[model samples]
Target: MHRHTRRTVITTLLASSFALSGAVALAPSAGAAVPTASCTVTPNASGTSVTIKGEGFTAPRNLNDGESTVPLSVDANGNFQVTRFQKNVDYTVLAVKEDQNFTFVNCKVVKAGDTSGNATGNNAKDAKRGAGDGYRAGRSAAQKSCDVKATPNKNQQHSDAYWKAWQTGADAAFNRYC
Candidate 1:
């Protein structure tokens, strides 16, 4: 009985030590930092141009402006800047980092210098509504065998937001139907 008790205590101590070591091994190291990314867009030239600044991104960064993707250069501190980025419509800018990690920010380029703080939301709503309307119109044009084009008419009296949205909708409709 004495021998068995001694053996049991020894086994328990060994098992406990092994479990503690395993947990320590599995713990994350203090230097194992998580990757991060961010971006900001500044409208320029009445929304015709934009300056995008980004930080916390690794090398091989790229900027995706909903319409095109352009490679970017990063400084030693993992920051990037894109100046004079041409843009006509409001854009959802994406900052892509290594290994497909990315972050996105919406830029309201159409309403330049509008500091109302509601421009982004309002523009999004307008774009949504315009897309819907354009889609419907495109469907109708397809049914009527009319040319479905997204080109804005100079004579049409519509808000820039609305017209841009309409063009997008019409173009999408044309692709799907015509």
Candidate 2:
């Protein structure tokens, strides 16, 4: 067979195999579909920013986990982030699965800001990661590891004062820098 003819035959076979497999139907020549936000959170630093540090994020979030209040953007990736939260705060994450609204709560100390309502279903691992060891608990009176409130945890109970102190510290750190 002619060399050029062999080359053409090889190319045709490769293309046919790809078409049949359909694993990579979208090639370099093809356009990649832009992924939209799925699961997210809003920091709400009120309006300041430095750099948000959460996974599966994009513009308009201004996350800067360092801020007091920032909006978070949730994606299908189920990504979570953490800041030095000293005090106890309330938090919640909303996820939409198949157009059904679902809320996950009772974990974060302060409220986790609502996503722009643009979040779709979240990845289980990422969503669990964002929850953060179950809220800041509180700064140990010794200013050590986090402290937990006397309130009942998913597994146990703690003192309210402990939680209060932790919450106070958290509020100060978050509100001040943010």
Which lDDT tens digits does candidate 2 get at residues 115-140?
32322233333233322222332222
Q: At residue 160, give the lDDT of candidate 2.
A: 26
- RMSD to the true structure for each prediction, in A, is 16.8, 18.3
The CA lDDT at 171 in model 2 is 41
Best-fitting candidate, scored by lDDT: 1
Pick out the ten consecutive residues of candidate 2 with the lowest summed lDDT: 133-142
Backbone clash tally (model 1): 0
Residue 85 CA displacement from its true place in model 2, Å = 3.6
Error of 1 at 71 (Å): 0.6
Regions of model 1 farther than 4 Å from truth: 1-35, 88-178
TM-score, prediction 2 = 0.20
Listed per model in order, the count of residue pairs whose N, CA or C atoms clash below 3 Å is 0, 45
